[model samples]
Target: MAPLIAVAHGSRDPRSARVVTAAVAAIRARRPDLDVRVCFLDLNAPSVDQVIDAVATEGHSTAVVVPLLLGSAFHARVDLPGVLAAARARHPQLAIVQSNVLGHDHRLVDAVRDRIVAIGVAADDTRTGVVLAAVGSSDLRANDRTRALAAVLAGDTRWAETTVCFVTSTEPNVGQAISLLRSRGVERIVIAPWFLAPGRLTDRLEAAALQAAPDVVFSETIGAHPLVADVALDRYDTAVVAAARTRLSA
Candidate 1:
């Protein structure tokens, strides 16, 4: 089996790395025989380059790099590619196939729904307004994708209203979203973080929401959910098949 390298966007908060570790562990639990490793793109140990070098030293000629990201923002488009290019150059014998970022997948939406339910919101609760919160990006398309996911989540969960908000680099910040919900006469509102792990941004979003509405409910980051593990494995399998096809074509 090809080694599965799960790369995450690191954070200064220690809990962030721990959450990622748990997520990788979930993947390992599902595929116990598979070799799984966790690395970070920044602010954490075992960087992507280090992980790639270790896999190469372990004598694996091919490996799969799975990006633990929700959207194709700056990290996915620019940082991960540059890191992979450097890794390929360093380990010439290793064939590292990069997998797609975990974009607006239904499983992810399910994970969000699960988080909402964990916070005591019923699936068919029409009185509670839901706010999908994310670490915003300069890429308009990335923001658009988040909005689309918010719509899907609202429809699937049958919430009364769903709105998109950002923690940075975008409008309708968490505070603004909560205000909008409150203005619409929503007495109970839940902010579902569109993040894989708990970090500074999640904390910031929660703080902002509390300031806006002291009674607002904030859900946990979608960490180590079974559905997320399934998505990680799916990306790994898809990358492996794609790599084999490329090899045969060559």
Candidate 2:
């Protein structure tokens, strides 16, 4: 079987790497025979290039590169493709098939709901407002995807209201979202970080949420959840199967 290379958007915070590592471990636990490796796109060690090079050196002719990203933003669209192209040029013998970004999966929604519930918010709490906080992107469509996810969560979890917010790069910043909720007479607001791991952005989101409303509840980052491992494997399998079909057709 081809190795699974899980690539994440690295962070300066060490906790972020740890969470990603844990998620990879979860994947290993689920499939002990599969060879799974973790790499980062930036701010951490063992970059995507390094991982690809290492896998090639280890005698793997083909491998699956799964972007552990939640949206089709800059990193997924531009950076990852650029890296893979460079890696392919450098190692012509290695067949590195890239997978799609992890976007808007129901398992992810369940993960977010699980986090909110862990923070004492009931699933049917119609009075509690939710602010689905994420690291904002320069692309409007990417930000819109976050809003769509918030809408899905609102409907699925039966929260009174769920609004989208960003920690950077876009409108409706965390403070603004919380204020909007407050204006809507939602005294009990919970800020759910739509992140797979804890990092500087999560800290900023938490601080902003507390400043906006003293009694605001903040959920933990959705780190190393079993559902994430499932999604990673799904992406890997999809990529591998597609690559096989393409090769056979060629």
The TM-score that candidate 1 achieves is 0.97
lDDT of 1 at 39: 97
Total residue pair clashes for candidate 1: 0
Candidate lDDT values, in order: 0.90, 0.88
The alpha-carbon lDDT assigned to residue 213 of candidate 1 equals: 84
In Å, residue 163's CA in model 2 sits off its true spot by 1.0
- Which segments of candidate 2 are over 4 A away from where they belong? none
On lDDT, the candidate that comes out on top is 1
Cα-based RMSD of the predictions, in order?
1.1, 1.3
Estimate TM-scores for all models: 0.97, 0.96
lDDT at 187 for candidate 2? Answer: 61
